[model samples]
Target: MRNANVMTASSEGALCSATRRIMLISPMPNRVRNLLAALTDHCFDVFSLHEWDDGMLDSLKPQLVIYDALPIASQPDAYNRWREQELQKASSRMNIPLLLLMPEEERQSLENKASVHVMRWPSEPEAALLEIKRIAERAQDVYDSRRAGESIVFKDLTIDPGKMIVTRGPEQIGLTKTEYDLLLHFITSDGSVQTREALLDIVWGQQFYAGSNVVDVHIKSLRKKLQDNAVSPRYIATVRGAGYRLADQ
Candidate 1:
């Protein structure tokens, strides 16, 4: 029997021989428990809870989340409130990939936030595990790629793709991993006004809704770093409703 208590919060920092620390976020305790077993079979450290807890969350930073987006019609508004809070900070602290459980319509409606990956529940546990592992693996790949982009420089701004480090003139800009990837995408595109569709295709590959304000949100952060101005835009350039471009001047 595999001992579930031996796993850490992180999936061995990058890649583990185990399935890594996977948090199953479902309102139902039974579902959480069952999924925990599935994760266990894959050698993962699993955490389960009816609602988000500050202290527990503060300690274990999960690498991946299996978010069962079951409707909260009767589950109380508290669960909904709790989810909003957790989802808000999740992308910031850890770029954990989420598997949302909801109706196809609900999943389509959530087509806005790029922070979470929404998927209707799968029929087979094996297939579900496959999807879970695939997302987690891709997340690791993204993290690895950003490391090399850490030292990338764009005129006034200097970004170390390897370390997720960014420096603008004298001040530094702290960017999330997604933010960093978006910036790098513009840089590597050869000053092209990469459409949101292209950005979605290139950056996320096939994770979630790539066309969401995720691009806008990340660009907003990038603009702040480049000193939001009209003089020379510096790093990222606005192609106006089309997409964004990396400016030379």
Candidate 2:
């Protein structure tokens, strides 16, 4: 456990012979931590971190990495910069799955490189775990379907699903998994107005929070990445209080 506050949460079930190791690089709320404890028996070993280190990557060799990208507010610029650099190194150097939970305000400020997945914080533990499982499955699919070379063309944007890459004209747009999936849903729906609830169900696979503006934040992020104007948009269109659409027509 080192310096982390560790907990073993599990129900009445025999422990699995093999367990997937998870290195959590953030502070979880007590309620969420309690929920995560249920997963310990389900073949999951979670370890939270109060600090960052490169040696952990070598020693832990975790199957997945979940990190917090929240602002310290008090930390000096140099300290924050160094931590970010180290985080990047950990992601790039290790070919494992990396999930980042950050404040919506900090999303644009952080680099989207290194194939790191992003999700908003203050999420339900079960929902977060479910999302992580989905990502793991998708990663496996990518590995197995490496030779398929599958891609989808939506207007000027070309999405390579297998590689999780999006290219518009000549430049490649770096998008987190959620952003890419949301865009894919919009494009495939052919500009149909998608309700916020529906978007949450489809993209997140679960509605973790009701009346949360998480959807809007992600949509805003997608628009920014696609260079689509919010007002008189070329691609994504906000349907006032209704929802959002791809603006196909």
Candidate 3:
């Protein structure tokens, strides 16, 4: 007989292998047992904590954080305020979504925020699981759309295609048209080595002489502007026999 604890392919079809990481924060462990089990059954990798740790979010990197605030709702107003503030701080820094589970009566007490979703507590396990899945799926969609329109980040370097800007840490790096095109090509190549001939066609086009060393000249200028050391590069790296590729790190 298949163990009930084991997730089968049919059972995992909804969430599948691409399960989202969920951080569940609850003071009342007894009350959350059923919800935790349900989440596990649905293929969510849950990290449960009795209390909030400021560093947990950064370390665990959960896509969604569910804070069971029902226990805190009955506490002194001051204690509730402190808890909310801590949750806000952690969620804002990581820009992850927060799902606050509270009593229906306490709904009006909390203000709505883009990153925060509130759901009534003491719900049936299946109902809570459905709501949690809905919130998580919506959050993932928003994140995907935002990332599609956002800057490309590699290590400490950020490339904003929309603004046509590149920055290494706090300093902005300027590049000429050819240099910018070359750097952008390397980034989009997904760290794959680009041969000189390939890069010439992509960035310089076929109009330029095939034997010209213009690629090397512009790459040097780009490296200097971005403060990348070819010998020990932080951004771009040369593959010797091959051509250039973005740094893996």
Candidate 4:
């Protein structure tokens, strides 16, 4: 696999704080270059991948994936089928939304699916970028509105609130009710420090009085279950005199 070509909006001025991360997957070198050029002015961190790799996908943790499917669509039926099967498997394993670009003639072969947006290939760069922006915005909106009912994904961890289950990668890590609530609060804190007193009020309820060390004890247990190191945390981070916050990615 070719090394991913990264494009940032830093050339314009300061990087946009809300810049979205996009992974462009295409076997065609020219197409990848063209798309990267088109996105240069946008507030997006584009990672152009010449070939699809789930390992890279996990590592990148992009907000959206743009799969240029024209090459595969033009292949022999058997070859196309195999490639499509692999794509489906990779997509199924992640919560990131997909934007598929295919020829108009080949579009009919594909089915409509949730979180998968389709657009015709050979589109003008302007139109393609607009559609990509729209899909990314829509996906974010859906995630925000349905957060309580849907799975919350952060890096490699996934929390299914509906099921009250948390998984790191493919392995499920069991957590008690308090531990689960504490972790959920941390994820939703949006990197802000959560004071121990505030955490007690939110997770343990205002009426439940506890010693100063109660939050620390549960946090230690939660960190252990998440396999996070307090010294070098992947999920939670200490703030010295301040409370805790979700570690920066």
Candidate 5:
């Protein structure tokens, strides 16, 4: 890792409650990097493995290692085989989460694997973020399961309408007030779609004229912390003629 990029320990101080050390294994795949960048204001320590030294197996520990969607190769068997080798021993931190972004078709083959969580790539971004949150939650469960030697399950991520906290699984996703309210509206619509207008109405409280794109900005912010894909999905379906919905997966 480059010293210029890594913050000094004194500057880092204690990890903020909302902050985490995330090590991403792939290049900014599927616009997911934008989402990670979105988290900068919230105190995230995001590092792409491409930026790490070969000694990652021994140093530069992180709370999670995300393996994002890559361009599909002509040979998937050879691809996955080679992929496995990279992950097999690189992460010595056993508790760290491994979030794998994949196509819906390829997801099943890796479903039974231990410690790896998969989200279908190529869905609209709305669905991707929901799935990312779901995956983060799942990773937390896996961590807990190993620690306590028990199985675990989670419902759609829980957002406290009153407390402003979003609990994805074992971890509480940190959210700014605006981002939290936006998600609350998305989840509370009973799976119904909400238009940009509706989102503006709910989130900004009373609409004004003019194309603000404010909704788009906030959505971008939400997507990063959730580690969502802009193209594929598991929740938050985009209704081209309508708006966005928490779709049934």
Candidate 6:
């Protein structure tokens, strides 16, 4: 029952709203340290954990999980068996993808096991990151399909178009019609910068209003409703000189 050590790195200049987030977990501190060093400048939002934490999996809602299965010195066989069971449960229950890194010897034992995918452990850090990227992209495609018309999930925020609902964590945030429409535009163009003029045209259905800060005003109001700070936004970020884009988180 050791306390978990956690490290999270969300890279700057990364496509904030477009990339899939990943959670990395291992019991060995040295292994976790090495992997974090390798992923120093990677784009994806990575939340690394050493030791088990029950609340982490649900709270993060990561698109992918990378489990580095270094054998525990105390009880290698029993620990791995338990981990396999827990991972299988997480995969089926949450529909979250799981990638396991284990020794070649363990592969034979895991044959015909549940849906957990495995890669030989202790590969070069770059190679591991590359494989993780491939899996995450594939998983993201499936995630996108399931979320297509039902709702949009970005970090902790969920926007449901059908119900005209917007929530941050457990609380529902009310928005004006215009604010909701504007937010929807930002979600649809997740990775792209949307200029104020562009937003005005799309959201307001008008040409151009010279020197009018109508877009800015609405954006300010919208941020207030979403509990987002324009200066240091959690959802919508003001891209100086470029306009606005949703924060990747």
lDDT of 1 by residue, 1-249 (tens): 122244433423544454567666565655545556666666777877655554555577666766765656776577666666665555333334556666677677654443456666535566677877877776555455565553555676676765667787778787777777887666644343455655665566546664557767767876765566534676766665556666665
Off by over 4 Å in 1: 1-17, 76-78, 144-249
Instruction: Report the lDDT tens digits of candidate 3 across residue range 161-197.
Output: 7677888888888778788878866665435455576
Q: What is the alpha-carbon lDDT of model 3 when measured against the actual structure?
A: 0.70
Give the 10-residue window scoring lowest on summed lDDT in candidate 4. 108-117
Q: What tens digits encode model 6's per-residue C-alpha lDDT throughout 1-249? A: 333333244456444444456777877757666666655456566677775455888887888887887688799889978786666455434446577778888865653243456777777877888877777775675467447756777777788877888898889988989898888766654234565655665677655565438888989999888778877788788777657776765
In TM-score terms, candidate 4 sits at 0.53
The regions of model 5 sitting more than 4 angstroms off are 1-17, 27-31, 51-54, 69-78, 90-93, 123-249
Error of 6 at 5 (Å): 10
Residue 116 shift from truth in candidate 1, angstroms: 0.7
In order of lDDT, best first, we have 4, 3, 6, 2, 1, 5
Better of 1 and 6 by lDDT: 6
After TM-score superposition, the amount by which residue 139's alpha carbon in candidate 3 deviates from its true location, in angstroms, is: 2.7
Query: In terms of lDDT, which candidate is strongest?
Result: 4
Question: lDDT (0-100) at residue 188 of candidate 5?
Answer: 39
TM-score of each: 0.53, 0.47, 0.51, 0.53, 0.41, 0.51
Model 3: residues >4 Å from true position, as ranges? 1-16, 72-78, 111-115, 144-249
What lDDT is reached at residue 147 by model 2? 46
Q: State the lDDT at 17 in candidate 2.
A: 61
* Model 4 regions lying over 4 Å from their true place: 10-15, 72-75, 111-115, 142-249
Candidate 6, lDDT over the whole model: 0.69
Residue-level lDDT of model 5, residues 62-157, one tens digit each, is 655667645446766776666666544332223345666777777765553433456676456556545555545545545544456443222457
Query: What is the Å distance of residue 146 in model 3 from its true position?
Result: 5.5
| lDDT tens digits, residue span 1-249, model 2 | 344433344455554665567777754334245434654645577766655666876787766777766656676576568656755565334545677776666654443332356776666667777877766655544443444766767678887877889998889999999998888766654243566766776677653665548899999999999999988888898877667777755
The 10-residue segment with the lowest total lDDT in model 1: 1-10
Candidates in order: C-alpha RMSD to true structure:
10.8, 12.9, 18.0, 16.8, 18.1, 18.6
